[model samples]
Target: MARNDGYEDLGAWSEFGTVSGMVAARTTESLTEAHTGLGDRPDDLDGLPDVTVGVSAAEAIGDLAAELSPPPPKGYDNEVDADGDGTLDDATYRGRADGGVDILVDVDGDGRTDFIGADTDLDNRVDHADYDKDGDGVFEKRMFDDDGDGFLDRSVFLNPGS
Candidate 1:
């Protein structure tokens, strides 16, 4: 198991015989199970060594689904009140260890989520977002990182002609 705590460096290491269920990281700022020391071992490793180097950071921590558990939803204590009503109408869900966050906003204070911003890949950046302009259970605008470069580059409108 390889881990990074954002304060140490990870160098190349060689493994010899029959490596199975190996989670290795080559970056110095990755959050793996080895970093937080929390999570359960995966059940379906194919007996091949897994290396998380130049590929994707998600590849390094994907197996630790149980490790990157998200926290319970709570009130979003920010200053952006879309409806301008004094009461905050947004709630946020964050990861317990990894750097992932999801914010749900009720624009009209109607108890329905009209906007969602998230960093689903744990990259400390908002790479996906959905906007339900009317808060009627359907998103009208969506943006996401189609290339997985940790940036939201693609945008689509659900009702283009509307």
Candidate 2:
């Protein structure tokens, strides 16, 4: 008889809508161990881990998740006519979990952002920003948080064509 590589067993088990109880138990234990290795309290996904060792695992996970997630889709949480131009020139959007905020300005009433400022760490400071500094639609100046430490640590200027 050929050696059973477990695929045959898995296919057989799939017809029953569930794995065997023993397999399920082992799977659960493996998953629990993996979560524990990540410093997470497997029983409570939302609960912070015990931090006697150092930083809580939950905080680390949150920071990583925030960095990995895409920026909030382009939309304004608040709008105001900051330039007395009788049109909404300023738009702001608050970060979902980090309390950060993004501010966008539509300087020419084109419904497109001409300037962008963001506080990625919710520290009441702008950590990243872009500006169309020359009255052009293109953002020529950029401030970025190179270390993810909620500080704008780098600035870049781009030419018109590049």
How well does each candidate superpose onto the true structure, as a TM-score?
0.36, 0.33
Model 1 C-alpha lDDT per residue in residues 1-162, reported as the tens digit of each score: 344445333433323221322433334236543444556778667977666466444334433543566663353333233333666555545454444566566676665567666765555445677888775567799888778765568889978887
Candidate 2 residue-wise lDDT, 16-55, digit = tens: 5454776877888778445445674367566775556654
Q: What is the C-alpha local distance difference test score of each model?
A: 0.57, 0.60
The reply for model 1, stretches above 4 Å from the true place, is 1-69, 72-89, 94-99, 145-154, 159-162
Mark the regions of model 2 whose C-alpha exceeds 4 Å error after superposition. Answer: 1-89, 94-99, 144-154, 159-161
Worst 10 residues of 1 by lDDT: 14-23
Task: Pick the lDDT winner.
Answer: 2
Which 10 residues in a row give candidate 2 its minimum summed lDDT? 75-84
